[model samples]
Target: MTEALSLVPTTDARVARAIDLIWREADLLDRREYRAWDELYADDALYVIPIDRETDDFASVLNMVYDDTRMRRMRINRLTEGYAIAAVDAARTVRTVSRFVPLAVSDDEVTVRSAQILVAYKRDHHDLWAADVEHVVRLGADGDRIVRKVIRLVDSEAAVPAAGFLL
Candidate 1:
């Protein structure tokens, strides 16, 4: 996928802000800003890592290790608390976002679908993962900011070691 931008039937300001937010997230993740990254999420948003079978439902498999806002915060805190080894010696990572297509836009909710490629280097080893992530952001009722943002990783059953770093 390519980082191509298209004009949809969305408010120019909102679309611009969304793209800016995504880019900021990319920068933060690359810089290992765990706390700042955590703060970007909504208070009650959900992070779902589904099994690789092409299903979004997480009721049975329960593929989410960090599903709720509180859990996500704990994950960030754990990273900073020096409990997770990957956090202590974090991997050098970068995420390239592409094909940012706006699927739907209600009054205060917008859905962005994009493909991302994340590369990480750890201890002279490199790992690259590519997947499409759906970002559901609920713009505040006052049209000021994002109220809720949901992230669902496409490859949640890849048997990877630990997902200590954000994509």
Candidate 2:
């Protein structure tokens, strides 16, 4: 995949900014900085993980996870407040994001597509997960904010380990 995406240059300033934002978000999530990570999203942001890898029509098809701002707030609250036991004991994660391609760019919005490899480590155990990640970021006077994030897991149809933390 990386080789296939080599045609797209990563030197553009806008692309650099978008990639930086993505890396920051990943770092925050990996550190379990829920509040800080939540702040990266726009008020109307949507976070989605489709159950079927071939489809992204969340309204018509069931999704593994579909979250709006309210749902995201609840999720973050649970994780931070210790109400979610799985999250409280979730493994640490290190994510590598690559193949960043600018799908669309405008004065107020930037859409980027990338490949990700996430490694989760727990006591004497670890899991490796891969996915294609899309992020629609809205640029505001304040800064860049995430408007939508879609994650297509490579093994969506297979039984997978618990994903208590944000992908």
Candidate 3:
């Protein structure tokens, strides 16, 4: 039998903070707290859920979701308006966010990569979504905020359910 892995002590305070922020974000999304989730982003944040695994150029390729700050605000408005068809039958999500590895860390920015498993339940249907999420968090004068979030879905090329809320 394999031995249980022991938790290693993390040395960097920034990394700890980033992990906390990521977990809080995931919790907010799971709770459908969109307004609070939106506050975690920087003014010019870019959120992308790419359709193609090989392409990072959102402008040139078709993406599942690509939203700049204004577009993100519109999305939040649409979700909160109660008129969006996708939101009408929105699924409740339970997200498992783990393996938060800090790729890069600095005083001004922190780049982290993590794995996410989202289980969504609506009506009688349940869907499982998995992805590798990359977050570029910028350290603002006031606090840390996400500047970019790229969600590379493992089965992005396959057909998936409508994502009405933040992921």
The candidate that wins on TM-score is 2
Worst 10 residues of 1 by lDDT: 1-10
Note each model's CA RMSD in angstroms. 4.8, 3.9, 5.7
lDDT of 3 at 68: 97
Runs in model 2 with CA error above 4 Å? 1-8
Model 1: per-residue Cα lDDT over 1-167, one tens digit each = 21233546334555556766777878987898878887667776777655544655555665645367787778778878987887888888888987777776654656777788889888898888677767766666543333444344545665665756776
Q: What is the lDDT of residue 70 in candidate 3?
A: 97
* Superposition error at 152 for model 3 (Å): 0.5
Error of 3 at 136 (Å): 0.6
TM-score of each: 0.80, 0.91, 0.90
lDDT of 2 by residue, 1-167 (tens): 12223444567666677778999999998899989999999998999988788876786888888999999999899888887779889998999999888887666777889999999998889899899999988877889899999999999878889777889
User: Could you tally the backbone clashes for each prediction?
Assistant: 0, 0, 0
lDDT (C-alpha, whole model) for all candidates? 0.67, 0.85, 0.84
Off by over 4 Å in 1: 1-11, 141-155
| Tens-place lDDT digits, model 3, residues 1-167 | 21122322234676677777888999999998889999999988899999998887888988988999999999889988899988866889999998877777776777888899999998888989999999988876787899999999999999987777667
lDDT of 3: 0.84
For candidate 3, which ten residues in a row score worst on lDDT? Answer: 1-10
RMSD of 2: 3.9
